[model samples]
Target: MTSHYDWRGGREAMMRFGLADAPVVVIAPPPFEEANRLRALMATVARGLARQGLAAVIPDLPGTGESLTDIAATRLADWRDAFAAANEAAGPVRLIASVRAGALFDGGQGAVGHWRLTPQDGSRLLRELVRTRIAGLREDGREASSATLTEIARNDGIELSGHWFTPALFGDLEEAAPLPAHPLRTVRLDGDAQPADHRLAAAPLWRRAEPGNDLELAQLVADDIADWMRTCLGG
Candidate 1:
């Protein structure tokens, strides 16, 4: 079902699953383009959780999804506060399930536990965006590098892909890292060498050129979350 939650900025849309009174898992989706790629997978996971008798919500942060806010004006702090507010509105939220860059703002919500899938730091994300921009410029017979684009971003702002990133947002991202929450469980795909509590054997859906769904991977993720939530709830 679709619901709305009011934050300090304004109200934003969110998708809810399962019974209204059940313990909830608030999902913090990956930032920007990655979010679009994984939307289907996230929805599938949310529904799977519902089948396990748990509630879940996927909120649209300030400048993302169906939000009315301007992306160029949104900052990292705004996203963090908005995420915290969303969690408060989702009744009885027991945990947060975040993917990639989503982990950066999953804290400050007071959730008992956090489950992240291949969490990524802001610097790395920024670099990826910069690289993409440079690639586009090269195809047009133009010259630009990460350092040059970053300098432009610092002085004014830069448009990477379709999003306009403000100087403040770029600066914030340069120093942002995923919050180290207590009782956190990090999961990664099999090929990733990064340390994780668990690793699944599935291709990264976010890497696909188009949005896709992986029912098998979604089920694995949902089951892991259900088991983790049970442990966190002392069951």
Candidate 2:
């Protein structure tokens, strides 16, 4: 069962798979422009976790999704505050995050375990963002390059691809730290295979002009995550 409420000043859209006693896993959604493509998947995964008898709390990042904050004024520290607030309201739990770009914010400190899906380092993600932006502009009949976009957003700000792209924010995205070392449970629902290969071969859904929620793929991801959690922590 899912419910909505406010906690620690952040409005949370939660799905309690079962009960409060059930173990919880705070989900960190993908950050920035790609968030829309992954939000449904995150919610679906929460339902799947609930079916496996776990609770999931998904908090809207400070500057995104139902948040009462301005994206332009928001900084990484604000995101951290919202996440920490979710932690306070969530009680004891684990951390399970999907979408590689958001890995920088997971913190991974107090959780009993970490389950990251499609994790990528910051440098790679930032490079892709730049390329994607430039390509998008070119397609729009405007011959904008990475250097140009970087310069523009770096100077003021630009609204493209549903994000208020900014130079300062891009720098933060570039500086995101890597995940905590292994023995930290991680998985890749898509991308590559090799049992535990975490390399992502497919492009992000957010790149699509009209991103579709592939329910089939979402379900598959949910099932895999639930099974992994059950095995690792037991129901």
* Clash counts for all predictions: 0, 1
Model 2 ranges off by over 4 Å: 1-17, 181-183, 189-209
lDDT of 1 by residue, 1-235 (tens): 9999998999999999999999999999998879888999999999999999999999999998889998888999999999989898998657998999999999755687889999999999999889989989999999998998999999999898688899999999999999888898999999998999999999999878778899999999999999999988889
Candidate 1 Cα deviation (angstroms), residue 177: 0.4
Q: Write the per-residue lDDT of candidate 2 for residues 48-103, one digit (tens) a residue.
A: 77777777777677668866767887666666656656655675656455456666
Deviation of model 2 at 162, angstroms:
1.9
Using TM-score as the measure, the top candidate is 1
Candidate lDDT values, in order? 0.92, 0.64
